[model samples]
Target chain A: MSVTAAKGFTAAGIAAGIKENGNPDLALVVNNGPRRAAAGVFTSNRVKAAPVLWSEQVLASGQVSAVVLNSGGANACTGPKGFQDTHATAEKAAEVLGRGAIEVAVCSTGLIGVLLPMDKLLPGVETAAAQLSEHGGEKAAIAIKTTDTVHKTAVAEGDGWTVGGMAKGAGMLAPGLATMLVVITTDADVDSAVLDEALRAATRVTFDRVDSDGCMSTNDTVLLLASGASGVTPEYGEFADAVKTVCADLARQLIGDAEGASKDIRIEVVGAATEDDAVEVGRSIARNNLLKCALHGEDPNWGRVLSAIGTTSAAFEPDQLNVAINGVWVCKNGGVGEDRDKVDMRYREVHIVADLAAGEATATIWTNDLTADYVHENSAYSS
Target chain B: MSVTAAKGFTAAGIAAGIKENGNPDLALVVNNGPRRAAAGVFTSNRVKAAPVLWSEQVLASGQVSAVVLNSGGANACTGPKGFQDTHATAEKAAEVLGRGAIEVAVCSTGLIGVLLPMDKLLPGVETAAAQLSEHGGEKAAIAIKTTDTVHKTAVAEGDGWTVGGMAKGAGMLAPGLATMLVVITTDADVDSAVLDEALRAATRVTFDRVDSDGCMSTNDTVLLLASGASGVTPEYGEFADAVKTVCADLARQLIGDAEGASKDIRIEVVGAATEDDAVEVGRSIARNNLLKCALHGEDPNWGRVLSAIGTTSAAFEPDQLNVAINGVWVCKNGGVGEDRDKVDMRYREVHIVADLAAGEATATIWTNDLTADYVHENSAYSS
Candidate 1:
């Protein structure tokens, strides 16, 4: 169950002939709800996709009747024509579902700098609307995949309500909301303001902290829709926690499925002067290609970790820093501590802890190791 | 001709046994100067190597009679003992040359977090001092090699004086002086202040703009020594121009010799509102791994270029941006322009021009395309 796991949400996924391989490329999710409260977070990248630009406007009204997504073209950098295509897609979705055009959010993913195939996509939307079902969340997740090898979905339950979501991203994953398309639906009695707050708070610590490849995309977007079908209003904290749980689960899945990734690196930075400091240091460590390569080889190269931290302006003394990899404190007080050979890196998951020794604040950033396969996948991806 | 191409310098390279394979791991450059005025630049990385810390203080005296450089182990993150090793190395060089310890500078590269074998290093310094010759510049350059396929050197002649330098860096190359050990020597009758100004000015545009792998090393150090032996003092502009030329040549060499790189990418960011914006945009484009990988595949993916520029805070309207790969304008006015198939990318050099359409400022950054070989080389480097 993805978005359809929640109440009053119907979804469908279909092949639109947009992808040359004839794979599922179109998805439609409609909120047949008593409440249509919605919120969205978009990529911080200035060069946004046309769909992202259109969806932002749709979300501003605090309600989304439906979401139409397609994976074949990014609809980015195509000038005025790209924006027009996104507008047309929303209009088509609105017409088929009998909702206002302004209440339909459109999301597109795939190659950038290309226009969507409107003929295939518009017809696919009508077919998807006719076939919409309450158990079509998994199909919708698969439809949004670009290079992802598997679909990702998660669900979190409240007292009587439930929150469920789906995500798709395999590369160009680096903060700015983690460079992916995600749709979350809730059956709780909630207002748009609370939904916005919960989504932003959840993503700040979840999606915003994942920096798989340190390459931010132009089409990242996350939408949250509340249906109030359960009619049971949970406390703000409970509702927010549930949203965070689902987002964290989906974020973890994104890291696990990152394109050509070999090892999942979880970098936890502790003792930072502030949360921002921790995040800065964590991102620096996450983005260091040399360190990523060393981790891929299981060398336990803590020197690279220190080097990465040194590049940041975080409040940390060079000699006071400490680092541990795989539970082995390979570097202590900024020098060689435990024997590197003692660290076990045979597992696919690698845990690194960097102690700034500055304050109590901390943050963790998830990333993947640099590998030859990542290079191969990306070098030939667009072609 | 390398460092000793000037009139008052002697250099030598010797196998110090510091490297397990007994490669030439030690180099010594001495200035038999009527004037010992000098200048130096080091990595901005806060986690500096022991030798960098030692050399920073030595250069503070505005005089450097000798420089002792070693490969095989970077004396960084070794705590107080690492600093002690660097001090001892400098003292040994000063003792062998009968000069003040304060007048000696030390540089070390290779693996990080490892202490040098002082027993082998001190003895090797003596041997290098004994073998110092006016024609040993090539050997000195060769001794500094880590993964560099070949040694790099350049020289520029003025009215009568000459500037010559040597550099060694193949990986961990990103700003912070491009992560290398460089020794530039000049015979012009220049003071310490002028040498400092000229060196900084030249490096700001040359070495500082070459971002190969976007990993700044802790041991980056560049020193310029003016011996005043040529007895000819050219205007500062002429001297600075010569220094910039030599640095530019060495910077280009660094990009060409970048580890596992099949193509050298030159990113030119023009039409920026300010020089800082131009440099920021250029560096962002230079450091984009996705764009680099695309370039490695010889794919003229201008969308990746736009994505990189969008991530920067530089003054540029998304719709007003333009990009040219090689000679073809693949993206014009932030949209598709000329046919990407018309672009030629079979050459080793790839030129990318991003026009911001913001102002008149421009900057260029040199980088290398990401390749599978780079991943393989860095992954197993320490192992």
Candidate 2:
């Protein structure tokens, strides 16, 4: 199924004169039905943005009918003015959609500590509502991006159930949703409790595991809305599968668009004594900047990989670990093995498979390369 | 008590034609034989260099007389031949110094995975050993350089005893000892076991606390030599003080020379309820690339600081936290308190003080500003 295949979700994308570039910067998605059962996940950063605070309160009521997101101004660390901007955004969206302000969620991304331009924002909201369409899912995905080069969205349908999601993030990717902004819409007739459960589970194994640079963002958010437009009630297994598929797809897209990222690395850790050990090993490799830089240089420096894994608290001894990069066994039992030239990291996507040689537990983590553009963007960003 | 003032240690630095720029790359420091007790602390990384392995084995015997180090080739990841090269280096140094091979320690720094050119290396060692002098400490400090802009040296004197050291590293700084090569000398009467105790205690609170980047390295080593040439067996308190002071000074110098660093940030976490909590809290801020970049921009973004603290397991409520930047209390009790304009991070140094308002435990971490040069250096380094 495609992004537009999700039921009851009408989306719109519009240029709101909010960004320096004329890229689509305003997006709106609404649940047309009366049902507004929703569950939300916000960034774990304590220094949260005003929209995050407002949406966190809104989610407490277990109801959300609409989500209005704008790029180009993060409305973060702007004090009282930032809070007022999020409120005004929700209120303006509610006025256009004929819904209560409390039922409308709002998100903003881009330059932080800036006030939203209401003169541009209010008119933009009306235009988005008027421009709403069933095929606007991809457009909505494009509108909520900052450094991302492509829009990310995924949908899966089975047993008359559907799940569609769009995500935006390219840098500052690490832990607690990874500075990524995601919006999901579903019509599986699930309650808020199950939606919460499914979203958390999917995120734990998907978005939360994607650590590009190990930098957490303050404005990251993931929202899930179940409009219940589809009459069939899917079992937990099917619904969970649908959620996981969307998450995995969006996760892959995020890695692909990682800033200055010439390589998208999938680190799979297997044969750990426990699932936690597997996760620990995966995370150790994922956040290693030296290894990431080595990957960007397309050098299969397996020794760097093993050095990162050795730092973990996992029970596996270093001598029992085996690492294969790009389908070549570069190291075995803690010693250098075959020719390093057999591994190729030149591809935009690369896979690093590690065997702990212990128990049968396993895990995977996705990350990006270390690049000059990443440093350029970060150092020159605020300036 | 300056570097060259250590007893029985004659040092030299020379341009042995290792780096393309023709900077000094060969260094030597010899114990003039009143005592020869040695202790070493190496990087925890499992992927060690040939020099690291040889030194670890030699350190196991707790007997060493001299250390010969060079810059511009890490002698790492070059396979079995690398190990043989390191052994040959020790044997050569021992032959020239009229000492046993097992009594000579060797350290190499520079690019990883490259074989050391023994052509320049052998003659360079001969020149360094022949020209060693009591006043060559500064030159020796400059010899073992990589990306560092300046040499780092620290010294302390107490009750007729002297402690001195030199170090080099500009990147890959993190917990469990910053990724730099260090050699320390002392004239105190101490056995290998006692020297280990003193060195470990000093590094635990000094070099290990200065975490510029969260990346550990494979070639990090800290070697301590006690010659007892001054005939001074001072009190333990005096010896500990000397070690701590020398280490702290070296830690400061490492921060000052960090790659792409504009401002040196010192994060002090106080009343953290536990030493581990204090260290965790300080490290969270020290390793933050965003926070470091903000420091580069001279933006007193205390919000980022508070959020970093919240990410730790410091056992304090967010509201009980207070943050001060450059002596200005920017955040009080988890909220903005004063005008951030009063805070200035533009100097060569910056200070951030976080009060957990719990117990009296405290920790301080030194780090460098995030800048474009760091990225440029790492990205093109392997190329």
Candidate 3:
């Protein structure tokens, strides 16, 4: 059901000719509610897209009733004209939904440094608004895709309330929200402040830890909208847990569908002196290209893992470190421990445990193996 | 001529049966000098190899009589046994050369986390020492090859003094000395203090800027030995410039011979508010795998460059950035400028210029393109 899994949401997807190949490239979602509360997070990249800039302001007001999103052009690095186009898109969506322009949000994704086809995009917003229905959520999920092999959606049920979301990303997925556009909805009686806190807490551990390629994009955005249709404001912890569950599900889906990947690697860092140190160490191991290629070839190259760890400022002595691959302690005391041939690598999911042996803090990062197909896909993407 | 191009130096290369394929795997360079003053630099990685740990101590005395290098195994991450083996190798070299064990340095390269074959290596040291000759520098260079396609050698002559060096490295090259074993021999009359300052200054701008694959190795070493045989005490400035030229030459060769790479990218960052910022921006651009792949496909995708620049903490506004590819301005004022089609990328060398429009500081970094062949080579390496 995607976003419509929540009680007070309707959505639609439409083909707007924004994509040259005639794929559906536009989507709209409306929240009919007793309360219009929303929160958002965008890419940490300094060079943000125009739509990201526009939606940031809209989200600042802490209220939103409608959202318009499109794929096929990122509208990034297009200067002042791109900002105007994004503003115009929000205005068109607000007019079609019979709401004020300040109550609308906008998002865009695809090739960077290109302008959107506003002539087609503005009219498609009207068509999408007219076709919005509770059953249109899945279609809306499918519209915002570029290089993604499949659409991703997830939902979590609470006591008389629910949380649901949709995500689209396949490449350039790293920290700062994973280079995607995500829209999550909830049908609980929560204000904008609670929504903001829960969303930030959830994404901090979910989307922020999925580092597919260590390349952060310029047009990433994640928004959360709330409606009072359920009339039940659960405890803050319960609401945050639901949001985290949905975000983790969507983040996992993003990794599973990473571009040209054959294996999804879960790098778990253990026994760190601090959470930040664990995360830094995990990200370093996740970004080691040689190690990723070794894993892709089914070779348990723990030395590459140690080399990656050595490059970081994490707290650990080289001789005190240990590593396990698929539950086999291949490296102990920073040296060869078990026979590398004993480690199995025939599964699509690989688990690597790096023991820093510092204190007790831990962190996990999800990434993919480097492959020839990945090089081919990204090499020919912009051409 | 290589290291032996300078006076009072003798070297030899020998096959020790350490490699399963019977390739030359042992080399010895002896400085038969009136003055044996020396200086050395090593990898900044915390998880250093056993030989690096051993040689760092030898360099502390500021006098080195000989250096023994092997190519069959790196002897890294091997615990106490690895350090003992490194000490044993140095002891054998010192015994054969009639010097103290503390005056001998050892260097190893190849697969990490494995022990060298002591039975073959110790006896091979005797054979290499007996065969040492004034004209054996080329053979010494060849014996240190692991995955390198060619032996690297460079020479810089000043007045009556000469500086010459040999290096071997082909992969795992990044900042902190380019993941190679280098031996520089000079006949100029200089003290250890002068050699230390010159070596550090030379490597800071040359070897430290070559980031081939963004993977720093655990066993990078560069040693400079002065024999004082030429009897020409050149100025420190002239000696330093000569050392820098030789290092630059060898660094370029390492980039040219990077494993499975087809294109060499020279990223130059200009108009930075500080030199550190320029270096940070240049390295960020050079290590961008997406941009490297795009360049491999001959696509002048300036957006990826801007995206990389945005990730750094450099002082530059988004709207003030400009990028040039192969002398064509593809991006101006952070937006699209000239036609990307006008940039020619048909050659093996690709130049990228990023203008921060902040100040006049600049830096250059050399890297290699991401290729399917690189993935294939690394994936099947350790098996």
- State every prediction's TM-score relative to the real structure: 0.99, 0.87, 0.99
- Model 3 ranges with Cα > 4 A deviation: none
Query: Quality of candidate 3's docking, in CAPRI categories?
Result: medium
Name the regions of candidate 1 deviating beyond 4 angstroms: none
What CAPRI class is candidate 1?
high
In the range B160-201, model 3's lDDT, one tens digit per residue, is 999999999998899996789999999999999999999999
Q: Decide which is better by lDDT, 2 or 3.
A: 3
Model 1 / residue B153 / CA error / Å: 0.6
The weakest ten consecutive residues by lDDT in model 2 chain A span A374-383
Candidate 3: give the clashing pairs.
none
Task: Order the candidate numbers by DockQ, best to worst.
Answer: 1, 3, 2
Chain B, candidate 1: TM-score: 0.99
**Tens digit of per-residue lDDT, candidate 1, span A233-338:** 9999999999999999999999999988999999999999999999999999999999999889888999999999999999999989999999999899999899
TM-score of chain A of each: 0.99, 0.95, 0.99
